[model samples]
Target chain A: MKRNLRIMVIDDENIVGKRLKPALEKEGDIVETFTDARNALERFSEQQFDIVVSDIRMDDIDGLEVLEQVLARSEKTKVIIITGYATVEVAQEALVKGAFDFIAKPFKPNDLRTIIEKAAKELGR
Target chain B: MNITSGEAPIQTDDPQFSHHGLGEEYVEDIALKSRPIISIRFRLFLAFLVIFAFSMIVALWSIYALSEIQVKIRFLEAAGNYLTEIQQARRFEKNFLLYGTNLEDSLEHLRTAESILQKNKDTIEKILGRNSIQGMSLQLNNYHKVLEKVGEAGDTEERNRYEPELREYGGQLVSDATNFVVKEREAVEDALSLSRRVPFYFLGILMVLIIVITSFLVKNILSTLNRFLEYTNRIGEGDFSPILPKRKYRDEFSQLGLAFNHMIRELDKRHKILIESHKLRAVGTLVAGVAHELNNPLNNTMLTAGLLEEDFERLPDEEKLDMVQDIIKETERSKVIVRNLLDFARASDYKIIAMDLENLLEGSIRLVHNRVKLAKIELQMKLTPDLPPVHGDEQALQQVFINLILNAVDALPPRGKITVTDSKSSQAGFIEIKVSDNGPGIPEHILPRIFDPFFTTKVKEKGTGLGLSVSQGFVRRLGGNITVESRVGGGTTFTVLLPTTEVPSSVSAAPSP
Candidate 1:
């Protein structure tokens, strides 16, 4: 029952991706890091991911567009939104766009793991 | 001018706040409407007027005197000419005898008389010219005609007729000259009298004017100075009273007074606003402190009740009612905390009363005793015997003492010691209550602002930042003051001073009670 889950880590800050990837992988999900949203789009065409943990505020293309692209590719993929600048409206929009949950930056690894497990359970349904 | 927020008051509304580098706000209000320059300018004008009047009088006197002297000289010259004319007439009579019945002798006599007449005419012309009189030349021509007729009389009959005519003309001339001299003398005398009296009159008038002007100037200056002195006294006494007295003169002093009054009024307004805002901030801090104090006990009651309910579920049925009673007791405790908070926060009309300061201190200690025991802090109380009563609100004074004691207990480490001592102060004529604690002392940078609202030294969630600020407010309301002495790693001591009075009232209860 172990599924190969494609998890995309989209972060413009190099340190966020570098630090978060290993920790997220420790939760037993495959993680791919992409600094550029455009390159991430090209990669998305070749492979499909189970969850996208992307930073919402990024240069050029934002996480909302990525979420839109991932949903168009496959409707069942669960998106997990993360950002340092969290506001009520943004959280509402993420839920409306079919994101599993929204997590603010500076969160502990345990909080992220909890959200990932919940999202995985919901996806199984 | 003072503004306050109902909750979480952070700033005071004061236009002249100490943000511009001035240490504390010292406002001086001076009205610009009253000034002395106006009176001074008016006095100067009066002095100038008096001097101008005196100069005019002197000028008039000089002109009158010079004219009178010229008149006297003219009158004397007229008298002298008249006497000379009479002498010449007598000489003509002698010449007439010498040249009797000879045409040449008569001609010589007439020619000599003609020469004398010419001299008289020249003298009259000279006098007339000086006086600017016209038409006197006609009289000279008539005299010359009479002289020619006398010279032409060669026979005895002609001589007799012409001699009588010449003598009659001479007599008329002498009489007219004498009449003119008499009139001129009278005119000269009148002019001299007027001239002699003019200096006296002029000097008298000048003296009067000088006195009036000098007095007016001094009066104006003195009045203005008096107003300034009164205003300065008012300012010294913190009154900011009016700086100008009413005056009628429209001058520069009036303008200066207006400006000064405006400045003073502005300063007064600013000062009043600052004091009012300070009071509002103090009240806000008081309410916030009470609210914060109640919140901690309320939280404890909730936690204690929850623990009791959980323990009840595990206990036997026989002890279930007892557990409910404990819950009820905690609920009552919570209610008491809320009531104390409300009473402390309630705005009451301030009324003065005799306060037993030692009893108030004991009451405050009793209120905080439970918390001190819960915190496991040692408490000590040392009150000097025969401490006098003060004048203030019992509840407000108790609240201040409670706040300070609670703050001391909060600052202490587990099992730390707190000492509160009270003694009569001889120098201050009051009682001094010192609350000292063996806790970590406050930092140097934060010591000055300990009484400022929203300033806290304790770690987050342990302190609400309004205790000392509210305590300071309550002490100030009672006409008392609180000061702190502290150093890092050493204990802190807060000394509160309350003025003592011999007014007995309901607050002078036994300390143990």
Candidate 2:
């Protein structure tokens, strides 16, 4: 039996969080979505997750900062950055901060599924 | 003919006054335009002809008057010679009588001398007749008869009996000779005076005529030319309403004025037509831009509806999961189209900030990648690693790059290559972006109008033509420069120069020079 993996999605867009929640849930993962990075960070402080997927640009806090906060709390936890505003700098920065991989916006559901599986495997979930 | 080298005397030749307030380039262009493509040589030749004709006429008149003076001088000279000869003859006759050298013998000698004198008189009349020594033949004949009467007294005794008569005859001879001498001297003086006075008068009259003729010519031609120049200056200053006046003489200037008037009328009509066309094109561009914005969301809606229709049939089955994937994909597509539509139609208050240049360029490239793929154009980028940040709005700069990329794609034939390059210009303190194409370049006539709003080389249906112009506006708003260089049939290059500054979180920093 595959244990249900814990996943947190941080994105400003309501539709993205809404759609992505069910999609990740259908992959047999316990999914959590926070439209606010600050709230997500507060939630992240009290809990543990198998993987964290963050959008690069948000109204309150950027993905790089989100990566920083998450790494500060738990360096071993997997961080997969998802962003519409992907660039070499963002990718390199996210990767250097111990993110799993960087995915661009409008990504296929399979891409998300694959990344989350990799994170699950990395975590031995 | 001498060009005065001393400070060039304020150059009235340069028509511009300081107050007209145009740039040096514009003024220089105006000045160059003022000197039309008229043949300077022809004008010089015409001026020379007028002067030469006047000089030749003066020369001919002077020659005629001088020749008349020469004739009078010759006539006076001949008369002077004749008077001197007559006085010599009388002196010779007196010398013979005073010395009482051989009375009857001298009278015989005198007769022989008279015969010699008569022969010489014939020669004198012959020479004087060819000259203008008028009325001198009769005087010579009278002097010859006086000598004959003195010589016809055959003997000295007969001569002594008629001594008083001889003395009286001698008195008459001396008196007649003196009177003749006085008359001839007077005639010679009159002729010499006439010779001197007539030439002076003729020369004076000739000088006056030359002055009058040259003044008339210069006034007539220069005033006419000044009028032409004034009108041309007005035309150059964009004032085209002057009615070109005609001359009754039907000269070359008149013909040129008529032709110029016709040309200006034609140009004015063409300019009006061009203005109207430009307005129509602007309206068309607005309509097309609106249409393109509307079309994107419409397309997304159609794709979304199609996916929903497909997904409704696959429910409650093993492939229901596949149908969910399809729905998600379709929804993402709809989101993309909606986002693009908003970006295109959104009113923007762009703000500039110091941003990482490499990141900005990559983002712009990603934004336009789908279009590049759709156009079948290759997008080649060569971004220098560790490049500095630039001061600009990322979105606006992205729009500029996309506009240039789209323009390049349209300019190219299918599958052609478009290269986007980035490099640091140390001297400019800016990041230079070059988007170049290997397409057939813009036509020569259309090159200047490339950045004008609504001026398009593409067909009416194919382009709204606001891309380059809007790019220019955006670049300018960001305190940057965007310019295009095109070679007909070779290719086109769009260069965007953006001011570079410090990036906040970058590791390596460039030294400020």
Candidate 3:
């Protein structure tokens, strides 16, 4: 059997973290979630994760910073950016920052799960 | 507290009123506020009339003086002739006494002199007094009697007696005639000198009157013209208040005032529509942010509902119910966001009501939240809690704040801070609200004239140059004002001073200039 994947989801909206934590956990993987980007970044320094999922817009630290910080620590980790406004500039910028994938907001949990699985598959390489 | 965020439509709150802020009533009302036509021409005519009457009086007095002088000169000539006749009679008397010549000629001269005295008795009496003229006539009769006595005497002794009487009367007559001629000539000279002085005196008085009238008219017209010149300057700065009557009587300038009021109404109408258009443009700007903002709640709802559907059978009742509640709450949140924007886009009159500046300021900040977020600017507000309410139009005030905030956002780089601070002003009954940014400050040269209409540093597409001009106009109309302080490379702050009140303001009566 494949090893359990590690995932962290950061969104300022508490609901996103609360709901996504349980939904992703059903896949038999460990998941961490944060409603604040600062706390999320603090927690991120203490451990290693296989994938980082973060909303692009945040109060203190945005998703692009999370992506840079995550990659600076562990290049193997996959960073996926989530955005409420999926304009081309943001999508292009996120992708340019070594983000593994970009997803617009309001997507079904399964859609994100599929991207995470793909990111997981790539982590094995 | 947040009526704008409420679901009920804003228009229903004031059904009797409409978005059409003004109508033709004001134009007609102002144009028709005319008093009687006390035109400038009428005033000039009255001035000339006074001058004309004064001139006629002077002319008539001069004519009277000339006539008096003529009468004196005529009487002087008659008196000179009487003197000549008396002297001639005396000469003839001397001849008759010396050579025994015929006395007829002397008698004839005496008769002519007496006739002259008789003919000019009234005039001579008027000049020399009734008593003096009568004494002179008695002397003349005595002299004539003496001469006749000398001529009628037959012996030398008789003639000798008459000779002394005749010589005495003759000397008296000559001296008296000379005195009358000298006094009457002096009277003629006095009358001529008086007539000459009359014209000079009239000229001095006329000059003084002309100066008085001319200065009065010049000052009246000039002061009014200066007032109008100042009015043009005020109106050019975007003050649209009508020119009201300051004088008791009307004049041509009053008609000009009416015309100014008319022009102001039209200009104000065009400016209102411009502001309306700018508001629409602002709404357009907010729509993009609003659309992006809506997705946050929608995203939450989607994630929650999706999970609920996937785990519907396996989930505990509590978990399912929580997901359902989350979905409902998120939907309600979405509704409020949309409603707030809709209320701002709706047009309203300059309706004055007591409003919480804190709530209104916060709402304005929220409207531009997306623009600020997109630019990564840090926007914050520090309002003193429990501050008294201010009187203003809610929609218009929101626009004012939003414009200020948006301008700050545009001027800032990413991570720049925009601080909105408010407190009670030092002036009584007013609150001062300041919107400040730490971005590269506006240059000092451009600071003062930023409130001028069509004066903008931004590109044509980005700015209509009416934002601050329109904002200042609105605030002044409500008896408030906006001021700005800026330093080159330091920062910029816009302070809006608003009056706090409990009653609906009679601000429409306020002269905005």
DockQ for all models, in order? 0.01, 0.03, 0.58
Q: Looking at candidate 1, what is the lDDT of residue B226?
A: 76
Kindly list the per-residue Cα lDDT of model 1 for residues A14-77, writing each as its tens digit: 5445545655775567889898888887898899888888767565577887888888998888
Model 2 lDDT per residue over B139-170, tens place: 34444455455556565554345445545544
lDDT of 3 at B196: 74
How well does candidate 1 reproduce the true complex, by DockQ? 0.01
The true-versus-predicted C-alpha distance at residue B395 of model 1, in Å, is 8.8
What is candidate 2's CA lDDT for residue A61? 78
What's the ranking of the predictions by TM-score, best on top? 3, 2, 1
Provide the DockQ value for model 3.
Answer: 0.58
- lDDT per residue for candidate 1 within B211-326, as digits (tens), equals 88788777877777677677655443334344443654445555555555555555555544544554454446445444434443333334334444445456577655654565
lDDT string for model 3 (B1-513, tens) is 111110121222332223333333443334435556678999999999999999998889778878877877887788888899888898888788777785788889989999999999999899889988998999999988888878788976788778878888888888989999999888888878887788788889889999999999999999999999999997787776677777777888987877776676656656656765676777788888899899999999999999999999999999899999999999999998988877877656567677777778878887888789889899988989877788888878888888889989889989999999999999999999999999898888888889987688888888888888878877876778999988877889999999887454532321110
Top candidate when judged by DockQ against the true structure: 3
Query: Weakest 10 consecutive residues, lDDT, candidate 2 chain A?
Result: A14-23
Work out the TM-score per prediction. Answer: 0.41, 0.42, 0.77
